[model samples]
Target chain A: MAVFTRGFGGHHPEADRPLPPGQHLTADFPVLSAGPTPNVDAARWELTVRTESGAEHRWDWAGLQAMPAEDVTVDIHCVTRWSKHDTRWRGVPVDAFFEDVETAADFVVAHSYGGYTTNVPLDDLLDGRAWVAYEYEGDPLEPVHGGPVRLLVPHLYFWKSAKWLRGLTLHEHDEPGFWEQNGYHLYGDPWSEQRYS
Target chain B: MNTWHVAQVVAVGRLTSTARTLTLAVPGFAGAVAGQHVDLRLTAPDGYQAVRSYSLARVGRDEVVELAVDRVDDGEVSTYLVDVAEVGDRMEVRGPLGGFFVWHPDDVGPVQLVAGGSGVVPLAAMVRARATSGSPAPFRLLCSVRSPADAFWADELSAPDGVATTWVYTREAPPGVTRPVGRLSAADVDAHVIPPGERARVFVCGPTGFVESAAALLLDAGHDPARIRTERFGGT
Candidate 1:
C-alpha cells in the first residue's frame, strides 16, 4: 500500500489530453542518456541489420536518404514519467529496412554509436510502428537529441528508441539491453506503466 | 528487484531559496552507495500519484536517507518537496538506482566530479562517503551554479575537506571573487579539472545542456570517453 503524502495535491493533466499512468505532460523534450553524446558524421554513418541466420543488410547515410521517407507526428512517453504529445519526426520506417530480409527471430537488439543498446520485439518494428528518425520538428536532429539517426518506436517507452543508432541484431531469445540490464523494464510499454522490472 | 518502501520524512532543512533537504527514515532499508538515486512517489488524498527521481545526498545503512531537491519552475513534485511537504510526510521510495554513475570508496585513481546546479547532490554524497570511510583516493569537485546563493551545501563545500573544490558562477560570484561571472568555458575546465594524462575517473552530472557542454569540454581536453561518466537531467 502506498502512503498518502499530506499537502501533496499532484499536478493534474488536462482532461482532454489523457496520459499514461504515472506520466505527466511536459512541453519540453528532455534528453536522458547514460554517457557522453557520440559525434556521428552523416557521411560515415551506417546502419546494419543482422538476422539470426547471420545474414546482414546494410545502409549507409546516402542509402538511407534514398529510401522512401515519412513525416510522422506521434506521442512519445519516456519511462522517466514525462510524455510529450504530437512530436514531429521524419524517417524511414523500420519495416522498409526489413522488407527484403528474412528473419525467424522474435526480438531485436538495437545498437547505438555510444555503446548504448535497447531491446524490442520484432513485431513492434513493423506495420508503421517504428522508424529510424533523422529529423525532428522539420530540422536535422541535433546530436544532443540523437543526431545522424535514431530508432523511433513510439509505442514503447522512449528508451526503446535507441539514440545514435548503429545496427540491429535479431535474436530468437529476448536479451535485455543497457537500461533493461540496469533495472528498467525489458519490454517497456507506457500505457501499461511497465516502467521497472 | 524494485520494491517500494514506505519512508517518513524525519527532518527537512533549507538548502537555498529553491532547494531543500529531506531526511527520511525507512525500516529495513539496506544502505545505498554514493551517487545512486531513488524514485520517490507521492500519493495525494485522492490516490493520484506522482513520482520523481532524486539523487541520494547521503548514503549508508543507517535506515535514514537524505534527498536534496531543487524546485524547477512550475514543477509539481519539486514544489511540494521544496515547500509544502513537512517532516511527518510519508512517501514511497524505490531504489538506490543506476549503478553506472555510482562512486565506491575502494575505487582507485583520482576521481573528478563535475556538477551543475542541483546535480551536486550525489557528488556531495560521494564526498561525505569518502570522508567517512577515510578513503585515500584523491577527489576533486567542480561545481557550476547561477550564483553563490544558488550553490547547494555552500558552506560545507566552501570549507576545506579532503576534496579540492572549484566554483563557476554563471550569474553572480562572491564579494571577493576575482573570476568573472559567466557560463563555464573550456578554459575553466582546463584550468580546474584534472588533466587527462592522470586518468582520473570523471563523473559529470547536470542539466542536459550543462552535461553536454561539460562532457564536450572534457573530451576536447583529451579525456578518455570511457573514463568519463555522465548523468543528465533534462532541461535547457
Candidate 2:
C-alpha cells in the first residue's frame, strides 16, 4: 500500500511561472554529471555534424564565433526536479549551423568531449529551439557548467543539453544516449514530465 | 530499472545536527554499487510530491537500502527526510541510478575520495564496501566540513579501518589538531590524497563550489582529469 508521511506537507513556494509537474524552483543551479568535467580549450574546440548520408559539416572555434549569435533568456528544468528561471545564455543557434547542411535524418545524438551522449529529435534542434551556448550570465561558461560550449535545449530536461558538446550525428532512427541508455527518458519533455523511460 | 519501488523506513539514526540516516526496506532491490544514488519521492496527504536524489550510504545485494540526508536550509525534501521522517514512514525510490560514478570491488586501483560536508555519505559507502569485500585497494579520504560537529559518521571515520582518513575543518577544529581551520587548499589535497604518480582514481562530491575547487586542485596537482569523477549537489 502506498503510504504518505504524516506532517509532511510539501514546501513549494508560489512561483510566478507555473513549474512543470513534479518540479520545484531552485535559485541555485545544480550540476549533475556522470564523470569528471572535460576541460576543452576554445582554441582547439570543434563541432561536427555528421549526417546519415555520411557527410560531415565541421566548424572550428573561430568559425563558430563568426556565425551570428543570439542572446537568450530561458528557464531550464532538470529531471532531478530543480528548475531555474530566466537563465541567460549566448550561442549560435543550431539552425545557423545547419543552414547550408543537408540532412534527411530525423534524429540527432549529441556527443560530448567526455564521451557523454544524449539523443534529441532533429526538429527540436531547428526552429530556434536550441543553441551551442558558450556563455552564461554574460560570462564565459565555466567547465563545470559545460564550458567552453554545451548544447542548450531549454524545452527538454536539462540532461538533453549535453555538456562539453563536441559533435552531433544525424540518425535515420532514434538512438538512446548515455542517460537514456541507463534510465533517463529519450526526447525528454518537461511539460509532460517525461523524466524516466 | 526506472520503475519506482515502495520503500518503508525501517530504521533511523542521527548522524549530526543537520544530517540523519534512513534505512529503507526496498523489496526486489538487487543492490547498488558504491557511489550510486537513488531518487527518493515523498508524497503528502494532499497528493503533493517532492523528489530528491541522495547518494547511497550503504550498498549490497540485499533488500535493505540506507541513505544519509543533510538538511538544506529551506529544502522541502531534505527537511522531511532529516527531521520529520521516522520508522514506519514510507516513500518511493527509483535507482540504483548512475553508472559512471560507481566503484566495483573487482576494479583494481588506489581510490582517492574527496568530500565536502554531506558529500561524505557515498564515499563512506565505498569505505564500508572495501572493508566488507576484503578489497586490498588503498583508500584515502579527505573530508572537508564546517567544524568537528558538522562531520557525518564521526565515530566510524575517526577510527581508521584500512582507509587513511584526514579531516580538514573549515570553520573550527577540535583541540590538539595542527591543521589550521580554513577552507581546503591545494596543499591539503597534496599532503592527504594519493599523488598523481600513483594514478589513483579520484571521486569528489559535495556542493558545486567545493567540487569545482577540489577538482581544480587535483588537476593542478597533476592528477589525470579523466580519472577524477565528481558529483556536485546544489547549494553553497
Candidate 3:
C-alpha cells in the first residue's frame, strides 16, 4: 500500500449568489435516479389529470405537442446538492393545462410511468410555477435524464418534478412519494435546506 | 437516519488505475450487511461539503470497513479519496444504508450476480461472504468492463473457486480471446448467468443504462421479475 495526499477543494460561484443553501453549482447536468431508467414510447405516451369530482383531462403525445408551448430558462436544484442554473426548457404550462379542469382538491400527487409518485400543493402547479417539459436545450430530452415528458417544478427540490410523468391524482391530503417516504423532506424547499422530515 | 460519523483512514491501497480502496476505522461502528453502502462526506477547508455513497466491499465484525472508490471524471468526493486523502486523514461517513439490496449467507438456493464497472464492489462483498461461510450454494458472476486494464480485482475473481465468473469486454478484449469487444448481449448473459428455471436469486448493480438494459435482458429470459433485485447509480 502506498500513501497519497489529495485535495478536495473546489470553488462554486453559485455559493456567492442568491441560490439555495447547501447546494453547489454544477455546469453539467448530473442524472440521478433510484431505479432503472424507463424508456417510454411516444406513440403510447399520455398525461392525465384526475380529480375528486370524477373529472379527467388527458393528452397524448401529439395532443400535447399540438398545444401552444413556450421556452423558459430557470434555475433548478436537486436534493443531492447540485444545482444547474439557467436551464432552458420548452413545454406546456400547467396553467394552460388547468384551464378546462375544475377540482376541489388541495393536493396533487404526480404519477410516473415507472410507479414513482410525488405529492405537491395544488397551488404549486398554477400561477406560473410548473410545466410538463419535454424538450431541453432545443432538443428532445434524453430518457436517461427523464424524457418523453417530466414535471418541471423549479421552485422545489428536483424530485418533486416527477420524471416520466404519466398523470396527476388530486387528493384532499398530502402523500409522500418514493424518496419522501425514504427519509427525504416532503415539501423540499431548497432555500431553507429542508432535506429531511 | 443519515447521521454523520467521523472515520479515520487506517490504510489506502490501489485496486486499479482509476480505483482505490480506503479502509476506514470508525469508533463504535455498527456492522454492515453485504451490498449496503456508506455515505462518505468530504468537507473543504472553507467548510463546503459534498457526500457520495460507496458500497462496502466487505463486511466484518471489526470496527473498520473498506470502500473501493473509482475515481470518476470531475467527481469531487471520489477524486479526493483516490488522489489526495492520506492514511491519517479523517472524514465523515454514515450508515450501512439500505436493506433491500443486501444478501445474507444463509440465503438458500443459487445466486446470480450481474455487475457493470464499479457495481462489482457490492456484489464482491456477497461473493466473499459466500466463500468465507463455506457455503455450498452455487454462485455465478457476469462482469462487464471496457478492457483488462479497467477490470478490478482480476486476480481474486479469476482464482479457481466455487463461484463461476465471466468477463465481458466492450472496448478491448484480453489477448487470445475470441469474443469480439462489444457491449453485453443477451447471448453473453444467457451463457454466463444461471438460467431462470433453476430459480436463482438474481442481483444486478450498475449505472442506470446498464442496469436497465441488463434487467430487460434478464426479464426477456423469463426470470421472475419479483425475484430480481436491482440497484442503480449515476454513471460517472
Candidate 4:
C-alpha cells in the first residue's frame, strides 16, 4: 500500500510533542472496573446493528473477518484540549461493517463497554473516512484500548468513536454521550475549537 | 498550542510516602499567572511517553517551576510521578499553560476558588502567587477534600489572614475545624458566590462530578455561567 504524508496517526515530521499515552493510563482507574481481555474464541464476539427502522441484527466475529480492512492515521483531538497528532490504526472497512445491516442510516450512536456511548450524524460515518478499527499502531489492538473491534470516525471528537465498541444503533435524532449530554458541544471539531458547552 | 521548552528537574522531594513535588527550572520558563498549569511529559524506558498536566503549586520567580502531584490509586502517569520519577530528571515540559483558569497579577476581582481533592493544586498556586505578588484581589478559597488526610495543600489554601478560606469535607470531619462538614450544597455555592457579586470571577477545579455538580449548584444559585470558569484534571 502507498503511504500518504498527511494521514491521521501517520508520522508528523515536525510536531515533536510527547507521543500518545498508549493503550491505557500506565495506572488503573480505581473508580471503573478493569477492561475485558480478548481471547481466541471468535464466537464470543458479536457485532450488532440497530437500523433506523427499528430492526436489530447481530454479526459474529467470523462474519466481520470476511470483509476488507483499511488503515487510518488521523490526528486525535480530545475535548480536554490535548491534541495528539498522527496516530496510526488499521481496521475493518466501513462498507464491510455495514454490509449485513439493512441500511447505513443518517444517524448512528456507538455503544460500548463501561456504559459509554457517543452519537454522530449518519452522513459522517460513511463520508469516506470512517472504519471499524481492529488494529492500532500496526498490531492487534490490546483490549484496554478497544482491541479486536472499534469504530474509527476521525471527523468528530475522539469520544464520539466509542472504544470496546459492541454495536451501532441508528437513530433519527442525535443522542449525546455521557459528556455531550452534560452540556458539551454538539459537533466537537478540533479546528473549530469547541472545547466546552 | 504546540510550543514547548525543555526544562530540567532541579529538585524533587516527597510530600508524603505517596506524593512528591518535582521542581523544574526552565532558564526563562515563562512565569505562570497563578491559576495556569504545566504539562509534564515523561519518557518511559520503552521509548513511549505519557503526558500529564499538573497545576503549578507555586508561581513567580526566585525558584524553579514546581508542581505538587499526589499518587492517584489507578492513575498511569500519577503513579510514575509519585513512585518512579526522581530529582534531576530532564523531560520535555510545556506551559505555564491554560488561559481560562489564569490569575494574573493585575486581576483584582473578588476572586473565589472552589476546588476538590487534588484540584487544590492550581488554586493553591493562585493563592501562593497572589500572596507573593500582593495582588490583594479579595481572594477566597473553598477547598474540599475527602478528609484532612487527603487535603493536597491544606496549609496554604486556608491561610487565616487577609485571604478568606473555607475547607469543605465530604466524608469524615475533625473536631473544632470551623469548616463545613459535608459536600458543597446549593446553599454553600450561593453563600460564597452571591456576596462576591458579579465582579468576582469564580474559579472551579476538581474531579468531574465535583466541578460539574458544584458549577451547576453555583449557576442554580444565580452566578453567571460566563463568570464561573472550570478546569478538570482527567477526561471526566
Which model scores highest in TM-score?
Answer: 1
Candidate 1, chain A: TM-score against the reference: 0.96
Model 2: per-residue Cα lDDT over B84-146, one tens digit each: 898988898888888777788897699999999999999999988988899989889999999
- Highest DockQ against the true fold, candidate: 1
**Candidate 1 local lDDT, B123-232, one digit each (tens):** 99999888888999988999999998899987787678568999999999989988899998988988999999999999999999999999999999999888888888
DockQ of each: 0.73, 0.62, 0.23, 0.04
- The weakest ten consecutive residues by lDDT in model 1 chain A span A10-19
lDDT of 3 by residue, B136-227 (tens): 88999999999998888877887786589999999999998899999989999779989999999888988767887898888788787667
lDDT of 2 by residue, A65-177 (tens): 89999999999999888899999999999999888788889999999998999999999999999999999999999888899999999999999999998999999999999
Rank order (by DockQ, best first): 1, 2, 3, 4
- DockQ head-to-head 1 vs 4, winner: 1
Worst 10 residues of 3 chain B by lDDT: B227-236
Evaluation by lDDT, superior candidate among 2 and 4: 2
Give the runs in model 3 whose Cα sits over 4 Å from its true position. Answer: A1-8, A11-19, B28-31, B60-63, B98-111, B129-139, B158-162, B196-202, B207-209, B212-216, B219-236
Error of 3 at A18 (Å): 4.8
What tens-digit string does per-residue lDDT give for candidate 3 at A100-161?
88888889999998787898999998988999999999999878667989999999999999
lDDT of 4 by residue, A47-165 (tens): 78888887878777777777676677876656443555666888775665665677645778888754557777777777467888878788876554565677778766676767777
- Report the CAPRI category for model 3: incorrect
Candidate 4, position A190, lDDT: 55
Maximum-lDDT candidate? 1
